[model samples]
Target: MYETKKWKSKFFIVAFGQAISLLGSHGVQFALIWWLAEKTSSPLMLGISGLVAYLPMTLFSPVAGIAADRLNRKIICIVSDLSMGILAAVYAGLLFFFDLPVWTVFIMLCARGIGNTFQQPAIQSIIPQLVPSDQLVKTNGWMQLMNAGSFFLGPVIGASLYAAFPMSVVLISDIIGAALASAALAVVKVPELEKHQLEQEPIARQLKEGFTVFQADSKLFYLVLGEALCMFFYAPLSSFYPLMTSDYFNLSAMYGSAVELAFALGMMISSLMFSSVLKIKRKIRTSFIGLFGMGISAAVCGLIPPTYWGWFFFAAACVCLGASGNIHSIPLTAYIQETVAPERMGRAFSVLTLISSVTMPVGLLAASPVAEKVGVNVWFFLSGAIMIIITSILIWYSKMKRRHP
Candidate 1:
């Protein structure tokens, strides 16, 4: 049994530690992408990099989720962080001595993605164990705030450090961050699954059980499918953010950092509103507003002129995109946490990840050629329009079901 009173303290400690690691992660990610962008200056190369970074996570989520349910969740997190730290240290050491090829970078990213595959589901599932049922939404909001803060600072710091020092220096921070994360996790006593809840079954049957649990809720199932489709458009555009700022706008990495900062700021503001001031009873409807808002904002981002003034407009749209994305994502997450059985939470989240993650890489691969040929902006415009159409149809369908039911 958990000490109810101490839940707040424990949750904050975990959140703080994760924030440190995430900050380092964001900085490293910015450095790597910017370095690659500077070196290749090709959309196709960037798309390929995104593919390598995300593919491992997508492929391994089912297994990872199973481990989270069966194994010691805290140990899984600690091992994952340590593994990533080892990878970072090795990468830093290699980069220190010699100029690593692009393939080497891809290998590093793939490994990191694999580590993340295990860490994410474990971390997400742990929250419900630590916090009370009523506080789940607030806790998730705080987590978002922590994430946004890291994102807000990471790119600017990464850009500045990369400009002054080597990429190796930026990566070293990840090792330190990882060590701290492991230390924090080690001290916390995460609850274990009861023997009855832990089924010693074959992987395929367990995987199918995960999907079946998720499929039990038809409304959430369809809504998740809708989110999956939106991701097909959103993911590629996100990977091309650097090109949109630097290549299309003919700006510097600092400008790219600023755009990212703007997005983070937007997330922070919206998270604060949702957690504190806003009382959203209708989660599904609110998520639709978020989805529809993101589509419109994305379209505006593509349509903006490639001028100094237009960059301001683009950044503004990004703020809305961030805000809307939070609105879209948080409620659904909270819904899952609230409704799903605790024993099955990890597998449930994994199923959600599987549904959402599969589309992203496909979209990246599909968009790479189109973006390379037509330009990054054209795909952004088209994706945004398609999202708008999708959202409209879903809204109508939702209304019709309400009336008919």
Candidate 2:
């Protein structure tokens, strides 16, 4: 049995802080996208903003990972949160005083991405320190629940705030969320790992070490590749889903919120199930299964009739997609924590983030043009098919490796 009392308090505190932060950040993100859409009515602009927001994660993840590995992870988390808060405040000022130009939003997104590059790896690294090995899955489940809750609440709150007050209010809320997260990190005491005595290395050398560790493990390498591919296709769904629901499905913005809420509900339900009852002996296989399910859900969602029933079907699909995807993700995360040396965990996760983020912009960029040339329905169909093919290939490859070995 794991020692619950020793670490549970810290775990809950950190989790609560993250939940609060996510709620605010996600709320602001949705509002920003809606504002852009209302202003420009351009999918291309939204895609570009999404690309800018994520590009930093691709560019800086390796370096961020190295810093997380070499420096104090707790300090990294705190500083990143504070920086994000300051940046959000800047955005609030821009929205309040100046005309909210597209370029300004893009720049702010880039700044936010920089903060994320540091925070993502640091938070993942810190989780292992806070919880026992056996509880990793449960902890991840709770994390997912928080994520789902944020998704569920953020858009609703954002829409309400945008309706009642100005965009500045939403931005101010985001700043507060970041400030609270930083404060939470300050209060918590994260135990540190013994520093590894490596020869003092150049920045490039340290960055290269992250890549080397990832490459040395074939299973992890392929897993990262799979994750990247999934993100490549799925990332655009965020940009497209709103447009699709409003344009294609002829639903209101409320419908978009409904779809998001449905997806989050699915994730929450699955996260609960995983935390309580689900167990997978082989992490890789479980991941493969989850990927397969996600693909199927996407495909089915695409086939749903574009009517009221369509919305219901889409909601169902979101639930399946979110749940199965989370189920797969939790085990993979736990496996990584178990397999990677503690010293290298931050870098390894950063490398994972780097790979995942690199291809996402390409996916988002591709989404609009593809939808323009083909139809939105066709785009959905193609995305589902590609997802299925990729998941199938990974599953086959893993099975073949096992058989041959």
Candidate 3:
């Protein structure tokens, strides 16, 4: 049997610091959103800022992952946190001293994204080392629970802070949180892989070695491709949601926020359930089932007419979306962690992020004009239809049919 006491303490220390750090990050994110709304009041400007913030994560995750493998993983995590802390300080100081342009804010977000690209792979790769194999899923479930709580509360707290204080002060919270997280991580020791040192090979050859793991495991390969396809539908649909509310349901800011909160509630509820009550032995089967539920939810959103109950219908849809997201994501992540060699985890995850990033933007760009002509509801329906199709395909795949976690 595993020594529960030793690893349990390690996991909690890591999780505690991350929970605090994530809350602060979420607060800053929502503060920025409200700030932009007040200044430019243009959805276009907000969208552009989001794109800049996201691009680096897509572009550099693989490079970051490679670094995670090759370097001291604990140091990578600490450095990433400290890097963000420094950035937050600089930006907060700038806000205090002078009037900053909106473009500058975008640049700030881009830098943060770069830092997260490095941090994410390192963090995910280290988890296996901190906990026993039997407890990895439970640990991840708790992390997911923390994320859901942050999402539920972040915007409300952010908007309150924005109303009460200067932007500089709001940013200081993030800086402090990052500093604390880094301090906590500084004491933890992470094991380094020998394969990382076996790198007498060229950089290109090393990168190819990362890809070879997936080639050797065809089932994992197909699962990842299927996930990418699912995200193609999901990412655009998420981007389109706010507009869908305003145009179709005629929801005001209050209602929009309510719908979002309802979604968070679903994620929170599902996460708690997963953490305590649910035991998913058949992870692959669970994924398809959750996806089918998500698709049905999306289609229901489209089918609801513009009437008194439309807002209620939209809110319910958001709950379903949230429920589906948590259920689908948790198992999928556990599967990746359980399946891949620890040495290759960073590179594999980076590739997954890269694939998701590529398809989401494509879907976003493709849908706007189409939404203008065919109406947004068509896209919603289409999103649902595509997910159902993917689910069907996965179920029919004999390999997937035979698979379990």
The number of the candidate with the highest TM-score is 1
Return the TM-score for candidate 1, rounded to 2 decimals: 0.97
The pairs that clash in candidate 1 are: none
Q: Where does candidate 3 stray beyond 4 Å? A: 1-3, 37-43, 195-198, 240-256, 305-309, 370-378, 398-405
| TM-scores for every predicted model | 0.97, 0.95, 0.87
Q: What is the clash count for each candidate, in the order shown?
A: 0, 0, 0
**Candidate 1: residue 109 lDDT (0-100):** 89
Per-residue lDDT over 1-405 for candidate 2, one digit per residue giving the tens place of the 0 to 100 score: 224676888888898898889888888887788777767766677778879988999888988998888889899988888898898898788778987656688888899999999999999988888889888888888888888888789888887787778887789878888888888778888887786764277777777777777688777667767777887777677777666676668787677777777888888998887777877677777777777787787778778778877788888888887787786788888888877878888888898788667776888778878766655666666777888899889877966887896
Write model 1 residue lDDT over 1-405, tens digit each, in one string: 357989989998898889888888888899899998998889999998888888987899999888888888899899999999999999999999998886688999889989988998899989988988788778888888888898899898889889989988989878988999899888888877686435777778888877887578766766776788888988888789999988999999999999999999889988888777777777777888888988998898889989999999999999998898898888878888889887788888887677556777899989999999999989888889999999888888867876897
In order of lDDT, best first, we have: 1, 2, 3
Q: What do the candidate models score in CA lDDT, each in turn?
A: 0.86, 0.80, 0.74
**What lDDT is reached at residue 267 by model 2?**
87
Better of 2 and 3 by lDDT: 2
TM-score of 2: 0.95
Question: lDDT score, residue 348, model 1?
Answer: 83
Residue 337 lDDT, candidate 2, scale 0-100: 82
